[model samples]
Target: MALYKTIGAFLLFLGTVSGYANPGACSGTCVNTHDPSIIRRSDGTYFRFSTGGKIAVHTAPDITGPWTYKGAALPAGSSIDLGGNQDLWAPEVALVGNTYYLYYSVSKFGVQDSAIGVATSSSLDVGTWKDLGSTGIRSSSGKPYNAIDPNLINADGTYYITFGSFWKDIHQVAMKNPPKAVASGSSAVQVAFDPVKTDEEGAFVFKHGSYYYLFFSKGKCCGYDTSRPAAGEEYKILVCRSTSATGGYKDKSGKACTNGGGTVVLESHGNVYGPGGQGVYDDPVHGPVSIRSRKTIWLIMLIIFALQILYYHYVNTKIGFADGQKQFGWNTINFSSGWPVV
Candidate 1:
């Protein structure tokens, strides 16, 4: 009987350590963590980048972390100045061979003068990031037409980038190295899509199970008032899938993405408003998963829950002993009864 109890206790401890759902499964207060780029390191840690232009890391022995933030990967002074008030936004990160590349947009809202820049970091941790400078792939007028928001992917040893906001349409350019943008003369194909709203942006591409998934966000971002409906608005993450890398993109309803085809993957459920700017991470343990933030009370609740679970397990393991204990009389408990008191 002693050996049996010991084995059962060991199994319970393992369950507490290993069992968890994907972080992306979180609903409710999950808000506007837009334009997210995710990567799983060789050591099983998952790092993410977003429009904040500051990269964040989430380390878990597993994919579902009570994910703790380890400070900004890009320091406060690392951003490039594109004149007045134009800050960094919509960061896209990709890993090729031994190097990691970060592409981001530098612009202010409603401004045509914006440019995209690239930064490189071998480690995702804080202060290890280095800016590689602008891609030089400016707009047709040589000005920033919000030309900075970039999504990068590697296919068969070639690097391809897709970018652009609601100027005309999204544009795709091929790259040979980290900061070198595909030359203007190279065949840059416009992703066939018409914007329903000028605030539409945050484009990402991923190849999964023979289908290439193109994800984008539509509606206003970062604007508290100008962007409408508050939390549960029309601004949400949408997806289109194609068999080819750059063609045949269509919504689940069979509408062509070239003609505004999109299907919502993540949207506001209640107070969680306008969750856009998303990137997919192929997690080591949970497979492909997404990490986005929300603006609401619910996210606070989620954070509290996550923190509580982590603290209880890693910091307060003694408290967990009472969980499996059986309650006897009023205000009394007994672990000797074992679990599921039959």
Candidate 2:
């Protein structure tokens, strides 16, 4: 109980540091989530789609959510004829027209025979999801990229799905309309790569101003329990930007992202370790207000919850994800110096 309280206090401190207009913070009992993607409905309801429990669907009245699990989007698992369809991973949601499409990953750990699946919903409620099978994105042992961590981004007017894993880091491909699958005759383009075994993955592209910010997770991700991955080798969030969403992204040092260059957006700090599995969203009342689509006002709020498991600060020190299994966290993101500081 004391550990939980300490976690709460850190969350509050994070919000205070971010400098929100209201300085609202969140910290409570949170279930674990992997590769989470959150989006707000027209009614201001927030839906969080994540891995496990057949793409777990949790809804909340607010961003600092007392989130309530509604039901699995694919209760019986994906309709795709993949071997690990039952154990789907990396769910990314996109609202295209009146339909909400939820893209998921189908694979096991360390296996290259993987595919990205999709399902559609009109209301994002139980019994509303219709499986759409594969998005024609898959990877094999000989492939350079893995087909997990499906992140859909609407770059300018074109749609693209950026995904990959440890195999070759992150890759992007042009996506056609409706976003049920990749664009015809489109080939996967390498966007970001690390020469050192390429431990980066979980890529999310957010369009802020004239630049499209690409956020991704780097270093070892799972199976944490002391003396693992060293200290700096643990998972952390990194970012790069490109004028064109397809390629040519660079870090703050102006280093090309494809050549193992990335700027650290979020990393181990105090009690939060391996802080990754990130996505940026616009909240109507949190960070920076902007106009998205209609006349609705929105702010920037990022979801960076993928740590193995972190507890409270003990004796002025907090442990890393090597302590426990896994859990989740979210915080408001404020911009500074033309960078969306996560």
- CA lDDT, every prediction? 0.53, 0.74
Each model's number of backbone clashes? 13, 2
lDDT of 2: 0.74
Candidate 2: 10-residue stretch with minimal lDDT: 307-316
Residues 51-140, candidate 2, lDDT per residue (tens digit)? 788988888787667778887899989888778999889888889889999999999889989999989999988779999899999999
- The clash tally of candidate 1 reads 13
Write the residue-wise lDDT of candidate 1 on 1-342 in tens digits: 675455445544543464321123322211223455556678877554544435444344443443455655555533455652234666777776677887777666666677777777787666777876677655545432357678887756667788878776566777765435775466566664665644456777777556777777776544443434443444566778777776677887888876777776555432234445565544323331222554565343323222111000010122221212210000001112121000
Tell me how far the alpha carbon of residue 138 in candidate 1 is from the true structure, in angstroms, after superposition: 2.4
TM-score of each: 0.66, 0.83
